[model samples]
Target: MSRLYSDIFTNRASTGQASADLSEAHPKFAVNKVDFWYPGKQALYNISLTIPERSVVAFIGPSGCGKSTLLRVLNRMNDLIDGTRHTGDVNLDGKNIFAPEVNLVDLRRRVGMVFQKSNPFPKSIYENVVFGPRVAGQRDRARLDYLVERCLKQSALWNEVKDRLHTSALALSGGQQQRLCIARALATDPEVLLMDEPASALDPKSTNAIEDLIFELKKDYTIVIVTHNMQQAARVSDVTAFFFEGKLVESGLTEKIFTRPTQRQTEDYITGRFG
Candidate 1:
């Protein structure tokens, strides 16, 4: 049976245990001893990592190394896949996300995501930015108008498209559309953003724009990005995690991971000796 999104629109307070757990102090996200499977195959094996709040963490590895899979695990996006399962805990702000009480809708609202390809809704730019807030029952026209401008400015696309807010989002260039998507994610006021190779499909200039946005967004939102681009990872991430064959080979400061990785596999992958 599928798991139902708990509590719908109800705003349940954090449990006493959840409140007390906060006293112990932990990172924004704590994935401990996690093992994940997709039907017949295992995708991740006993992975553990901590992501500090208001920082960018990059997962870099060859394709199929489980970087994207782990990215989806953050907000339980994998739950949409049939027969997928995982063991262990993924905690956000000291609360286990897999706990029965976690409201899926709220969890997703708090942890917004962007994909490798820019996927703007076929609607107007204004509509795209206000989508999330509207779905959550926000009806104040003034507030929504404010969100559109604020989020677009935060995404660095306000000046470029401010005059065309009513234009279809698809009318924008690739980079602009991507920024619009970023603005949409920000509209929900998410605390965390999960980006799966967010710029891999864009041109160099567009890629740079996305990278700059990531740098700016990290000041307010914790970000986890999966990228095959080693240079991009090195440039944008505060911390880097290297994975190989579903196992976390090494993870640490980006400088250390790139210049002084302890694991031979990590060194080999980063040095272009092997993927």
Candidate 2:
């Protein structure tokens, strides 16, 4: 294994051992020495962080700082982009996700993602929610219906759209569309959910709704979100990591990172001193 991957694997093992000891008290996800590149450009540095299971971990930074890139790496979304390259390791539950034997499709199913923009399909609300399970080979009407209802409820959109399951997804408001996208993500029953500025384009009301939904979802799924909004990070995340120039500058409890960041760069960015 490369040095980066070796370090990552070792760290994941250590974090897993520690997490096992405190399993009843804390939730965690292990990310160790991860790096990524797009064609000729490197987007992430030697990044290592642990996000507790069932907890919210937020990445906050200015544009081009690799926040979104790191988020994509979590669920292997970067693989969809041609010319992309990666090094190091990203592991969940102590399993190295980049290993050759690991199935990318199954990994993605286990680790779902919500994009910056809400991209709902042209299909009906019900169809959107059932897309994942359907692709996974679930053809039973009853199972699809149950999955749709369950995920929609989990995303806090069932009550609003329950009466109109057959309605076109585009007919919904922007806020509703974003929620619908979230519900679609939940349909897969993923263990980890990655969000990249999921509420950035929504109105304040919608943003608040998304935030509330994130807080609620953490009770079941480990969430890793990348956002440029500092207050949003502080509001929703249990732990916050600050990135600058592709490097992870600092990471700690959200309260501390916002209020008492250890690194000067983190303080500068959070305090609006620099991007």
- How much lDDT does each candidate structure score? 0.87, 0.83
Candidate 1 has a TM-score of: 0.90
Our tally of clashes for model 1 stands at 0
Q: Residue 47 CA error for candidate 1 (Å)? A: 0.5
Name the runs in model 2 displaced over 4 angstroms.
1-28
Task: Estimate, for each residue in 120-237, the C-alpha lDDT of model 1 and write its tens digit.
Answer: 9999999999999999999999999999999999999999999999999999999999999999999999999999999988999999899878878877888999999987886777
TM-score for every candidate vs. truth? 0.90, 0.89
How accurate locally is residue 61 in candidate 2, as Cα lDDT from 0 to 100? 89
Pairs with steric clashes in candidate 2: 27-52, 27-53, 28-52, 28-53, 29-51
Tell me the deviation in Å of residue 111 in model 1: 0.6
